[model samples]
Target chain A: MTTTASAPGRPAPVKPGRPLRIRRRMTPRRAGSIALKTLVIGFLLAITVLPLIWLLLGSLKTQTEWLNSPSWALPENFLNFENYQVAWVDGDIGRYILNSALATFPSLALIVVLGVAAGFALEVLVWKGRGGVLLLFLAGIMVPGQMILLPLFSAYFQTHLTGTIWPLILTYTATGLPLTVFMMATYFRAVPREIFEAAAIDGASIYRSFLSIAFPMVRNAVFTVALVQFFFIWNDLLIALTFTSVGDFQTIQVGLLNFTGQFGQVQYGPTFAAICINVVGILVLYLFLNQRVMRGLTAGSVKG
Target chain B: MNNVFGNKRAVLVFVGPALLIYTVIMLVPVLWSLGYTLFTGSVITGFEFSGFDNFAKLFSDPKVGEALLFTLKYAVILTVGQVLVGYALSLLYVFWLRKASSLVRTLVFFPIVLPTVAVSLLFQKMFEVAPQNGIVNEFINFFGLPSVDWFGSPDTAFLVLVIMDIWRSMGFYAVLLYAGLLDIPEEVMESARLDGAGGWTLIRRIVIPMSLPVLLSSIIFSINGTLKVFDSVLALTNGGPGSSTTPLTLLMFRTAFSYGDYGYGSTIALLLTVICLLVTVFIFRSSRRDLTKG
Candidate 1:
């Protein structure tokens, strides 16, 4: 076999004598390759889907059925709402979900507004210390949340912000900024400088150009940042666990942990039901926006 | 354009709010935590200065050693699994599935968005060997193997944690690396195929070298992430049957919050930060050397 180095950005010389194959010819080797690929992919699909199915089936079962039945056994009634009611009411999952939304949306808004503005200015405008500022934000990404947990918790406690959603909102927004601003800067940098110049020549102020021209151009980046941060803040447990002490202020992940600790053993059905609620909430969002979610989440890492 | 864009007030308006918030909430706390390393008490008892005592305690503390060992072991195993499995899956997506891979990608990526606590609960039930065997054990029995009590021991519990976390996160790396793989020009692949480079040869010679940048980035990203793992392990094992599965982050959390040893906890936090920084620098240095040599 010939080994050839195909470095990117250098065009590989095409051999003139070789005919472009329009279709792959079937052979036993190819057939075996196809079989192996299918088997492996099928196994991956099963592993990914089966546990979620188990959760769904378990959620619908009665306690006796859940305990005694085979692990894969389907629930007798698929429409069972009893566990759902128990989880929603007794577990207070609904309230926790609302609290999660309360914390997430406001923080997301702040991250976007601030990230976009900073990203725009840092990348588009003439500024002296922009590189230093960007470096500062980038460095924040490496600081483990562990480092901040103790001090932030104490600060929040002293300021009487421990029991409220402010801690969650503030922490998420602040932590979310580095990546958001970095991503938005990347997006803004891709916009040609001439567009901003044209806007300036049209007598548009910096704010006016940013609001009308630059912002609309990077709406996709905004969406990406918002969606990524939404999932992050929503799925977070550590900060939520640390900051919110009052039951009324707890986010869904924290609430789920507490609910499972309390009801997981004796009430398997409702426990599974509670997990299913959180899963389904995210599953709906993922299904609706999986493409963008996938793109946004990968955008920052893959670009490097 | 320079005059319009260079207004100092506009620049401040654009950048100051984020800078201020990030400084106050994120940056200041890191400095504050660094300062806390010198003091030796929680807020309740009031801090007393004990210069470098916490650092002294960190070296001799057996629990810290065990937690550090667990964290390193977990990070190594999980990073390998996440990156290798993800790379393999991305190869499938690009080479085999191609345009038809989106549905499978979507299914695989589903778990990344699910709350870690929720997924941990599901895994706990799936591996339960107590009152009744979970599906895993049921499968083991189907093959005439004895049911394993997965969480009954530290080793088995660690295995379960690794499997659950890899399942949850490999999709993310797959997606990340998939985007990188997609950047390989079609002509380069076609040319390689013409030269009789197939399968492993094609990937090793062309694809791997071309995608090394993203692959290395993925490795760094995965390593740093696995190093700081807290939520998944917390929800899954809560530091486990004998504190055997506890990572540094969890140890730090318990030290500060539960044990009220803020100074020592901050020291632990500092250790983690240094480890992450070293790992990143090491990878970059090594990769840079490789690039130059190649």
Candidate 2:
């Protein structure tokens, strides 16, 4: 809601024609500031956009053309979809994408469900050893992911869960819990205590209050945490690679690695194509969940 | 009708599933890793419990020693660089460059959202040696500097990994810091200026102290992330050039997957966990007000 107001107190309606008058009376200092801003903005745009252009260009050109063509220039053709087809088929990125979705989706759902409960427990529910419980969750966040890899591998080995996505799915869910709980708890804390108190007076139990009142109020935050967890799980490569065999349950990131073998011959064209696909998928997801994450972060931090 | 259940039990019921899964998968694994540090190799070989033998071996292993040292060096450098560079970029975005922050945020955060494997591939092409059409080497040759054997030489490869990682992550830290900066009231800055505080004085005293929590959190984040680095290293160097840039995680990976020494790998992993715990405890102790008390 602070989006509209630059300052607190009286909200002034924007004066019509003021910007035009301001520009008409602009001093040299203002013009110089504007010019410098434009230059910097352009520089940032190039840095962001150029690599993508290079990736697209490389994807379009054949190996010979890619080596010979100037890196700055675009490819000659726009209709080239050969690389996409090749990446889809030869790279088998299509299957990997499916596997990634299957793994990430369940993990995302579990994070939201469990995270909401955890957030509720810490912030609202009265329990013995509350600080100890919260500390246990925080400890999960502090543990370096590397330290768990071997132990997880050994544990999974004993359980005969090797070469399966279940271990990865479970790990992602657990690893994601601390962050999701943090964000959700921060959000739920901001809801007026009176709302919960009123519900309690009405004989609504804590679970009832949470389910009927708190959860609905923080839907925006839940969406944000879900998006963040989705992105993390989707982009995760380490646990995916470590837990699964090369071809059995490979995700997109691990599948992408198969393009560059030990012989140093790289399938740059399809590899770039696969990267583009994955990036586009992420970008689309982000765009879809844009407002939730951005606003969620702001709300959570400002309160703290 | 609902009086049959109390609040405490309801809370436990609601929280139980998540706590169960997390403890079983995450907490148990940690304890199991710690346990692995005790047994000598495996049970199949009629293993005997050798108390702290693994921990002793860990201290004595030169490779482990080297990896830990290199990881510490890189983590220190990366944390400092990330905070400084990311803070500067955030300041630039918030104050000097408003419109560009919008554009640059997207650009910088773009890499962070991408899979790490793809980032490694992109960097590999950029850092490919000179006279071979790599982007970075092409620029080096253009400047008439001798092309660095990045990714080829032990001396320079670690630097390449560091640079690429920074490029990929600078935006994430920048975004976090930018958000922190944006939270400060403009009136505070104006008042500081009116009070005749110099630019550095205003930033160092007011802006920085206000954002200390975010800054500290960013440092902790960068340290943790750098310590567990695997995907980028695996894809880029695979701990090559005689293990010059092999971090602790990469070393642990080689121990388990490459060598099938699960017991030893778990030992390395446990030691790393202990180090991380110590560092995290230290950070928490120093910044408890910001992280926990707040």
Best by lDDT: 1
- lDDT string, candidate 1, A34-61, tens digits: 8987887798899999999989989999
Clashing pairs for model 2 are none
Encode model 1's per-residue lDDT on B1-294: one tens digit a residue: 679988889999999999999999999999999999999889767889999999999999999999999999999999999999999989989988888788889889889889999999889889988787788998999999999999999999999999999999888889889988999998999889889999899999999999999899999998999999999899888898989999999999999888898988999999999999999999999999999999
Measured against the true two-chain complex, the DockQ scores of the candidates, in the order shown, are 0.71, 0.47
TM-score of 1: 0.95
Q: Sum up the clashes in candidate 1.
A: 0
Instruction: State the TM-score, rounded to 2 decimals, of chain A in model 2.
Output: 0.85
Residue ranges of candidate 1 with Cα displaced over 4 Å: A1-19, A22-33
Question: Candidate 2 at residue B285, lDDT?
Answer: 85
Give one digit per residue, the lDDT tens place, for model 2 in B1-294.
324223667767767888888898888888877776687554223445788777788889999999998889888988898788789889888778776467577666666667788878877776776334666676777899977778778868888888878777777778888888888887787778779886689888889988887787787777777777788888888888888888899898787777766678788887777777678678868887655664
Clashing pairs in 1: none
